[model samples]
Target chain A: MPSILGFGACLPPRVVTHEELAERLGVEPGWILEACGIRERRWAQEETVVDLAEGAAREALSAGGLRPGDLGAIILGTGTPQRQFPGVSAELQRRLGCPGIPAFDVHLASSGGMVALCLARELCRAYGPVLAVGAERMSDIVQRDFVKETAILFGDGAGAAVVSPAEGPLEILEALWAADGDFASDLCLDSGGPLKMNGRTVIMQANRKLVATVETLLARAGRRTGEVDLFVFHQANLNLLRQVARTLGVEASKVPITLHRYGNTSAASVLIAAAEAWKEGRFHFGSLGLLAAFGAGFSWGGMLVEAR
Target chain B: MNTLDDIRALVAALAQAPLPEDPEASLFEAGVIDSFGVMDLVAQLEARFALKVPDEDMLPRKFESLSKIAAYVASRKA
Candidate 1:
């Protein structure tokens, strides 16, 4: 089975308060929060998406006792990239001095990170060691006028995990992905310039989509809700996280959340929370950790990782 | 202002949208509020009751239902 060699995440470190958004939008912070699960999100200051990815990738590589050259490929998942040309993955490869490596990008909106993990798992099975990164500088793309919604739900950051064929319980059990293109309008940044969302619709869609994904994943893995040791899903809003837990009939304490502090970092959300959980010594042998996400593409997926 | 009633009053004040028919239903389950909304309520509770909310206190369980919120504020006050 393919195992995670190491994982690392980076946050831009700038926090935007709700009061700031309320003052700018002429609406109370309470209105925004009720509509969306956001209070304070991170912002990237003088940091590019590639910069965050490189920093996180270096950490992961170092932790795994491997250098950039030891990696055979780089797969980055993100909705916001620095440029259309010289793709973010290539930039990370160059910055990390892993030239000529098979580097590419994955654009899955919010589920990009999990999707990248799925792809990395495949690559590791096919080759050996692969680095998968999910990074975003959402602050750069969010419009000033829409800062209330964008700033509160998204933070600028990156997370990376190295996947390699190994012996351990931390094997990738399975990843189940599903999306409803019909609900694409529920949550989106349609203007292509900033983040926009139909708050009411997103909350509704999330309630349904997330629960279904978890059910399918657990069923496929032949595991029950209580059997899963930890739940690490995307941090879009607090309600969605709790709703999924209730729907799945899992204990709320089993879920790990960083939204209060990190907000939502698109593809970086799940990985960041997982890395934090590992660092905190939350996982033990045979501990089942579930990772999932739903966002822009109206896309969502879940992966069951058994801890070694 | 330091009582549970004060917290309930603040919940009423800060709720820009309609309250759920089942006040006992999880605010999260009823889809009545999200995280940002909870933070807004927290901020209101802090300003209204003048209590400091540590980051650890910010969880859905505390704000899942109106009763839960009242309990949280009352316990903190006591």
Candidate 2:
């Protein structure tokens, strides 16, 4: 099984607090905090998605003690690509100077990063080392005037993880993913348009789907939920994550939440949480961690890992 | 567990807002409960009654107001 060798994350310098957004939107400052549990989020003033991705990738590689040439493949997960042609992964590969190995992008919306990790785990079976990065500049597409909910719920950031077959602290145990297209319209952003979301529907569906998918994954893996040392859920909503944790009977403290600091960075969320937690020494040897996410496609997935 | 007053109190507590005394008022339209609030209501109902509300049962109609939630809870209990 492939294991996570190292992880890294990068947030834009500009920090947009809820109070600032609330003042601009003419809403009570506490409303944003109560509604989304987001106190502050980062916005990219001039940095591109590629720049954030490159920075995170470099940090992960450095942490893993590997250079660009050592990577066997690059997998980029992002919903907000700078261009449709020539996916973000290709440019990232070029910038990282890893020209030969396979590189591409996967768009599972918020679940993109976790799905890329699942794919990278499989790729590691054949290739020795894989770099999976999820980067998004959500501020580029958000409409502050029209879509207030989504406007406040998104930020710009990127996260990367170096996965390889080598014995490491985080071993990929199992991965499970599923989607219900019937709810696709619940959250969507058409090209040349601002992101639109049925907040209630998305919340309900995400809660139901994430809970069910995680249960199934745990059952398939034959691991109890109590065995999980850390639960890194997508940083979509803080209250939603807490509700899901309560439903799953997992303690609130065990789940690492980054939504307050970074908002919902979409594909970068779970990986960002994982990287931040790892950096803080949250995972010890033999500790088990679970990562789960729900996104626009009504896509949801979970990955179980054991720290070596 | 079976009284409307009890149900109303639960709804008010979970919603963190007061509901109109009228049983037929639209909670959604009145801004008594939003989408995320609906989730909390469901979780509270499930925990309070030890009943699992199916995803399909989370319709707006089922939770329209205090009376509706009480009726729905009764139906699920039955």
Candidate 3:
């Protein structure tokens, strides 16, 4: 199994508090909090998505005790790519000074992070080590006036994880992916337009699919939900996380959440939360962890992992 | 069979916060239930009542209050 050797996250320095956003949008601060449990979010005012991804990738490489040249490939999971012609992974490879390695990007919306991880595990079978990153600069695309709901719910950040066939605390066990095109239009962004979402429909479909995805993943892994130690879900909304945890009978404390501070970083949400939790010494040997995410495309999945 | 009290209790439990006692009060306006909460409420209602709520029926008015949700469920049952 490919093990996650190191994790890293980079959040932009500029913090946008709910009050500031509320003032700008002409709404009460309390409404923002009640609507989505977000207090503040970081904005990449000067940095592009590549800059954030490079920062996080460097930290992950440093933590893993490996240099850029040691990576076999780089996989970037992002919806907000820096350019349309060349994938962010190629630019990241050049920026990291590893110009010849195989690199690519996955655009599975917010679930892009876990999807990249799953791809990294496969690449590790033939390669030495792979760098998987989820980076997004949602602040660049949201129109506060037109898309008020998603405007306040998104932030900008990046997270990276080093996956290699080595001994480590976190080992990849199983990964499952699923999608439904029926609700694809519920959450979407059109060309040259701000993000738009039918909040009610997205929430309803995501909750239903996420719970079922996790349950199926656990059952296939021959593990019960109660036996899992940690549940890291997409930091889409605090209320959604709470609702899913409650429905699944998982204790609130067992779920790591970063939405309140970072809001929804889209593709970077889960990895950022996981990296933060790992830095806090949350994972120990023999700990069982589950990663789940849902996003536009109606894409969703779960991955079961265990600490070695 | 689950009664209206059962539905009310489930709503309170799902809300995870004390709701206004007045059944006609707007849960959305009162901050008792948000968009995500509505999804959970719908899931619970489907399981408890064994009825599929049409997408058209997933409106704010239908789930505006405890009494409204209970009444909707009862209508589905009937």
Candidate 4:
């Protein structure tokens, strides 16, 4: 069996309050807070995506008691990359001096990090040690004028988790993924500029699709909603989180909500929240942790795991 | 401190970017400000001018142009 060996994250020093966004957009703070469940979001300075990824990866790698060269593979998940070329993983491999191990990118939108984690687990059978990183610099790509939706929902961040063969506090039991091409347009940045979101459509699609995925993963794992001790889902929006929690019959208290403080970091949301919960003494041995996420590809997935 | 220029001074200091000495500089499109930067600007404005920048006021127009932002702060002071 494989488990999370170590986890760490790095967040930008800056914080964007709701009032600052409301003052510019002409809407009330209630509009964003009620809509997105965000109070403040982290922002990077002049730092690049690679910088964020490296910072988090180093911490996770160090915590795992392994050097960069010891990593069998490195998987980076992010919607926002520093450059269109080379990818962040390649740069990270170079920075960490991990000579020829398999390093690549996974662009599953917000569900990317978990998707990468599952894939890393599969590869762990062949590759012993893997570094999974999710880093994003969404602030740089956002347009201040069109921030009503983008600004309130997105924040800059990076989170890394070390995965290795073990029989310990975290082991992925099952990962269930599904996508609907019809909902693809529900949320997108296809306008070629700032992020464009159809809030209602996205919320509806997420609520419906996410519930189905969670049920499927739970059933496959031979567990029920009540059996899980914690639910860690994607922080797409406050409405989505609440609605999904209700629809899935999971207690709000059981779910770790980081969007209130960190907003949405897409792929980094689940890992960041999970790392925080782990640090805060939230998870116990043999406790079941449920992970799920949904995003732009109209993609969604659920992961069932038992804490070692 | 209630004057428009006072607000401009606060915005300039917090943003740490060049603005027109004349005060018509655009903060949004000019890349002089961003969402994160807005939070810092609001804190400084709140302290320096003794005004509240509520969440509803988080609009580009409020901070789009230096003159506009200055006027907003001045109005709050008055």
Candidate 5:
């Protein structure tokens, strides 16, 4: 089993409060919080997706006690790339000074990080030291559209995890994924520029799928929800996360949520939350962690990991 | 089955609060139910009434008020 040797996150310096966004959108700040439960979000004023990704990658490598030369592969997950060509992971690879290793991107929207992690788990065997990163400049993708509800619900950040087959603090036990593209139009970002969303449907599908995936993954792993110590959920919507927590019969304390402060950083969210939780010493040796994420393709995935 | 009465009962059960006095009042604005309550209510209505609630018709406006929800339910039941 591939284990997460270490984790890291890079949040932008610029913090945008709900009041600031509300004033721009001509809505009340309190109303924004009530609707999405987001208080503020970090938006990058200068950093590109690759810059944040490199920052997180460097920290992850340092924490893993592995240098860039040790990395055999890089898998990045992002919806917002700095450019259309070469993918940000290549740039991240160049920045990390590991250019020869195979580097690619997964565009599964918010579920990208988990999908990338699951993918990295497979690659870690042949490519022993693999870096799975989720970075997004989401602030560049949203518009001031009150009706679409895109403006108030996004931020910018990046997170990375160093995965290796060698002994580590956490071992990946099981992973499960499912998708229904029928709901793709429910949430999308067309090439035209601004992000579009049907908040109602996205929340409905995401909440339902997240709960189902977590249950299925836990069952497949032969561990009851009680055996799991933490539920690192994608920072989609705070209210939606709470509802999913209730549905899972998981206590609120078991869930580490960054949505309140960082909003939805798209693919960066799940990793960012997980990395923050890790930094807080939330993962104890021999403990279990369950991660779940749902996003654009109406794609949802869950991963069970045991801390060694 | 009394459609209107059944809807009222379901609303009470799902939202855990009595419907507003004004049947046309927005349930969301009145803080009676959030999106989850509405989703659960729809599921219950489908199972209880044996009708399909189209995804397109899942918006709050479809069940914004007691009267609106009742109408939406009745139309599907019809």
Candidate 6:
């Protein structure tokens, strides 16, 4: 796998606090915190998914010290693409003025983000530089008048990573994932329909699988949980995060949390949180980290990376 | 013998919250554990009892109380 050229994240201009969501839904705002550990999330009032992706992709390109023309391919992992066909990757390619690059989309909800990162690493062996983006308009999948569980649990955002052969800050050590489609009914979003989830099933399955994957990856790499400098987990629920930390005996300081502020942006959550850590210098040089994400297909993934 | 005592300990650990003194008391009714916690308890039960708690048997009713969990475990072990 090639080095990670850059990391970037973009959030919408509009902020929807739990108070605002509660006021609109006529429910207590406190429940949002108690249930999911989110106080606020973003909603793209006028920005389309491509617009968010464009911003993040631009930032990632600039951070990597490359032009859009340097990109050989664009892979977008999105759970909420505005259109069914011709995903945001194609639109992002046009917006970036990279006309002939091979652009495609990977749809796996949250895990798609990590899957894109791993794929970009492999693709970099062939393509010069691959841009991997995880963008989602979870707010769009959630209808306000629908189930409050789904409504208050989503936000809008995008995150991008530039994977290139040129040595950069982060190096990939290992990446692995697994899925069980039998539980597909537990979390489903029908065409032109609001997102529905058996929240408990998602929480439990995600918790178990994510933890196991992290352990398996760590064991495979001959690393211990204590050696991990950072834990970049898919920002789903705060309670779930805490439980994972407890079960794994990982300290709170080892985790970078964005769910509390951004809610669950699905595919965008991990990248957003990782980008935040990078900005704060937490995901710094010599930092060994564990990356994990889970989503709808009952897919769970884990990746190990170290910054140099 | 009932697996009630073992199941009770598992529930307490999973919830990380207080459990009622009554073995027959409902964890859900007492808000002691949510559905996720119930699954966690199931996972622990499977590991401790050396049994595979099938996905179809993951209903909350099967693990609502210590008594229910014990009976389910015994039947599976049998």
Please give the TM-score that candidate 5 achieves against the real structure: 0.87
Q: Is candidate 1 or candidate 6 better by DockQ?
A: 6
Order of the predicted models by lDDT, top scorer first:
2, 3, 5, 6, 4, 1
Off by over 4 Å in 3: A143-147, B1-34, B50-78
Lowest summed lDDT across 10 adjacent residues in model 3 chain A is found at: A142-151
TM-score of chain B of each: 0.77, 0.86, 0.88, 0.75, 0.88, 0.89
lDDT agreement of model 1 with the native: 0.76
Clashing residue pairs in candidate 1 are A33-B36, A33-B37, A34-B37, A37-B35, A38-B36
In candidate 6, list every pair of residues with a backbone clash. Answer: none
In candidate 5, stretches whose alpha carbon ends up further than 4 angstroms from where it belongs are A143-148, B1-4, B15-34, B42-78
Worst 10 residues of 6 chain B by lDDT: B54-63
Best by lDDT: 2
TM-score of 2: 0.89
User: Poorest 10 consecutive residues of model 5 chain B by lDDT?
Assistant: B52-61
DockQ of each: 0.03, 0.45, 0.32, 0.02, 0.32, 0.38
Report lDDT per candidate: 0.76, 0.86, 0.85, 0.76, 0.85, 0.84
Error of 4 at A43 (Å): 1.1
Q: By lDDT, is 2 or 5 better?
A: 2
Lowest lDDT sum, 10 consecutive residues, model 1 chain B, at: B53-62
List, residue by residue over A68-169, the lDDT tens digit for candidate 5: 999989999999887887888888888888877899999887988888888888899997899999999888777533442777888999998999987789
Number of backbone clashes in candidate 3: 0
State the local distance difference test value for candidate 4. Answer: 0.76
lDDT tens string, model 3, A1-308?
Answer: 67888889999999999999899888899999988889999999889899999999998888788899999999999999978858888889989998777899998769898788878888887887999999999998775343567668989999999999766668888888777787778788776776778776677777777888889888888999999999999999887898899889999999998999999999888889989888887777788989889998878877888988
Could you give me the TM-score of model 3 versus the true structure? 0.85
lDDT by residue for model 6 (A58-99), tens:
988887788999998999999888888898888999999998
